[model samples]
Target chain A: MSVPFYDSGVASGLLSGILFGYVLEAAGFGSARKLTGQFSLKDWSVFKVMFTAVLVAAVGLYLLRLGGMIAGNSVYIPTLYLWAMAAGGLLIGAGFAMGGYCPGTSLVGIVSGRVDAVVFVVGMIVGTMAFAGVYEPIQGFYFAAKGPDAQRLPDLLGLPEWLILAVLIVVAIAGFVLGSRLERARGGPFTAEDVNGEDTSKAKNQNTTFNTEAGIVP
Target chain B: MTSSPRPFWPPLVAGAALGIALLISFLITGHGLGASGFVTRLSAQISGWLAPDLTTANAYFGPFLTAGAPLASWITWEVIGVLIGGYVGARTAGRSRLMVERGPQASVGQRFAFAFIGGALVGIGGRLARGCTSGLGLSGGATLAVAGFVFLAGFFIAGFVVSALVRRAWQ
Candidate 1:
């Protein structure tokens, strides 16, 4: 396929990035407290946002391809380097749990003026260089960490991708239901404003709100 | 006499917005979303800048030298937009507080220290795994990639484990 505008990905990427950032910030993902809420199960916002996005994209893309709206990228399914992916994900999760941001989300935090997010980004950059420098020393485990295949699970299982997507959507909806009930049980009777952590008056009115100064309604 | 701005959107709603953005991305370009690749490219460029011969000669940086302008990637630009968009989103939501996000128990210096270490882990992990949350979790996951689920499973399991150890960071 002919590349779109050859090298003007600047425009495409910039506009998309802008939208991506705007939505992330709107979700309150820029806040570490809000994000970490998932780890503690204090707030299900992170899980809610993430799974919802996954469901939408998975279902939407599958349908789009079916309808032939988007022919789709050739390597739609990423290669499953099982061990590397597992190890890397674990480490990144540790980072996310501790730093409260991923590379993409950290950008949102930095733009929103979180000092720690900035520090995290800096550290990631340095770490990338360090990893590159050490790449040669550990090629065996890193390079050879392959999964059974690089295709989507549906492809491997001989089912339609949309079917799995449907299954995922069902699971996500169930999760959403469970998350809501849990939230109510954890902190009863929260208004939209309190959940958003935007009401200054509410914070002022209550000495011991559910949330701390960071906005994870304690 | 004004309505309160929602501190954030409903996750479903916000996720819908994200879904649409991702759809547009696939429509226009045959790519999903990513963030760590930009950092890798930037690192290569920096290495090139610092030691022109090193970038040209090193194993990791050498391939980048042949791959045209690494700095002008879509992901790099997207991240730049992330910064701008994040600022706008935070301000719009009335949640743009410029401070370190740490638990009451953790000090500023300690929080920043952890932030750096955690970030470094992410960097190495992204490289080792060839993607990050946005890249692997969302982009690849959306495609029903098996690796996506693996990353997801690994991410949560390890995240929970580590959180147990460093519970003080964000108590």
Candidate 2:
């Protein structure tokens, strides 16, 4: 059908970001406290949403591939460079935990009116410039030990895609079950105030009664 | 044990929706999600606008210049959507807090410093790895990319370790 428009990358990028922003907003992810609370076990919304998204996408993509709607190979799967990814993740993670916002979330925070978000963003630019400055020394090592970029868990484990998808779905279900139980065990009504100080029950109820009705533990 | 009182989407529901968005992306465009790359690209544009001569001469900004589309690129528009969407989300949810988030014990200056440091690390790290948590960890992982998984694991480990070290920040 010759569907990827010449400017399609831009269109796709715009659509993708809008969808992402909607999802993040719907889930009440524009707050630093709620995000950071995930690490403290004070709130598990981030984990819940993140894992759920991964599970759904995994299952959906596998199904789409099976249906021949999307060619698995055409998708942009990154190359597996072990050291660079691990190191980069470590640094980014530290930033997330301490800063209470990742690069994306910090932008979210900015919209939510946190001055700290602006500061974090500024830091991000400086950091990027710093990376550029040192690109030469690091570039060679960063791309080193390059392995098959196509290696996925299923490929590494030599399992069928359906089986892997099934396992992931099951795991996601298990997480939901465990998370609910954990909240129940603690014994309290959940509130947006506790998570990020925003009452999302009413807002979310317009969206999903299953969660708000389920009630968060104390 | 006190149960968490914050009301938000159940993890499963939110994740599934997010996954669907990504799956839609793959089917429609043959790619996963992203954020940081565009940030770097936009930063380059700003640098260029601020200094045409230096930006053109700089080795790093060279690639983006080759692409020929300045501020009008897709990434810039997407980020604009992010701001608009985020604002809409926060306003709709009534979460528009015009305050600097810091631990009760720390001063605003101290919190700002950590945030700045942390942000810089993310900026640099995102560039080095060619993506950030969203671009690499979440989106890439969903695509079952090996690099995505590595990045995720590395990110979580680093976050958990540093969380302890910087416990006071959020405490």
Candidate 3:
């Protein structure tokens, strides 16, 4: 239950943030071209990485809870505001696809020295300020359709936690299989160089088999 | 100085590592990872400084001001760490570069415009949803929270639709 080293909230925040950011960058999520590849179906890294992480954390949390290492109420669960969450998701998804960066990934993009990412961050700040500016008029919509505090899927479905976890694992595995096939069909399994948009001109001049059309250079 | 970037880690590997990070976060902080909250707080702080009275009187920015110094929050420190960690990761992988990444057909101006517009939308949406990808999707999803799953579904569906419409920006 106690992690002596990171017991302090600040310590935990810094440590986890670093680890999270590092992994994201290493997975090539920092690259706009790469992250957006999901939309084009040219790459499945985003989906694969996201689902894998979700599964690992989900299973791990369940086990930890079962073992009583973490009290049930200790872990924070975001309150459900059905309307707000749905509307927010649509807006965020549109932004993500258009901008090719989420908040976390945008930070990663900034550190990777992408100028567009800097602009994106500025936009986020401005947007957030805009939200605050318009908060009063939209306040009702923001809090509409509120659900039970800390509503969980298992509770809603009236299913056991383990069963839900099992179903998710199966679903994730199925997705991975399908994703890999799609990638192969699309001449994918793209490298960092391909997705990062590395100097393709030089690569092309070198007579390497760079499929510009497919955006995959093997 | 111009070394080629390293290939990324296999997706599953990176995801598992990230998941472990998330797990450790729960064990330590009793919560999940986040990023937008830091931005929210930063915006609130800046707004407070610019218009203390108006900011404090607002419903959204008011609570942030009353909470204490925004920069002193936990999410703020975590975001700072994210910057450092991302830089380190990019440097080690030879992926750090100062350039505007965009589709070959897209101009630098176009990329910048989209980036800004997209970012602004994310900011508004993140606030409305009370979290972003990391906060709601990764953290809350792991906990089986209905909000997390709902956000994820909406995000992907909308993302794909928008991406298809704006395919030229990327493809």
Best by TM-score: 3
For model 3, residues A74-160, the per-residue Cα lDDT tens digits are 788988999999999999999999998999999999999899999998999999999999989988999999999999999899999
**Candidate 1 per-residue C-alpha lDDT over B1-171 given as tens digits, one digit per residue, 9 for 90 to 100:** 223435577788988888888766665556677889888898889888888887788788788977888786678888887878877776665666656777778999999999999999999899988999988998888778888888988888878788888888877
lDDT (Cα, tens digit) per residue for candidate 2, span A15-53: 767777767766767666667766655566766788778
lDDT of 1 at A7: 36
- Assess each prediction's global lDDT (C-alpha) against the native: 0.78, 0.73, 0.88
**For residues A33-147, what per-residue lDDT tens digits would candidate 1 score against the true structure?**
7777677766787778888888787777767666765555543467898788888899899988888888888888887778998899888988898888888887787867576
> Chain A TM-score for model 3, please?
0.89
Model 2 chain A weakest lDDT span, ten residues long:
A1-10
Highest DockQ model number: 3
Error of 3 at A71 (Å): 2.0
**How big is the positional error of residue B28 in model 2, measured in Å on the Cα after superposition?**
2.9
lDDT of 3 by residue, B12-113 (tens): 999999999888888777788999999999899999999999999988899878888877877887898888889999998888878898988999999999
Question: Candidate 2: where are CA atoms >4 Å away?
Answer: A1-11, A177-191, A195-218, B1-7, B50-54
Ranking by lDDT: 3, 1, 2
Expressed as tens digits, the lDDT of each residue in B60-162 for candidate 2 is 7767776685566666666776777777776666556677877667789989999899889988888867789788888787877778878978887777688
Predicted complex 2: DockQ: 0.51
Q: Model 3: how far is B162 from its true place, Å? A: 0.3
The all-Cα superposition gives candidate 2 an RMSD in Å to the true structure of 5.5
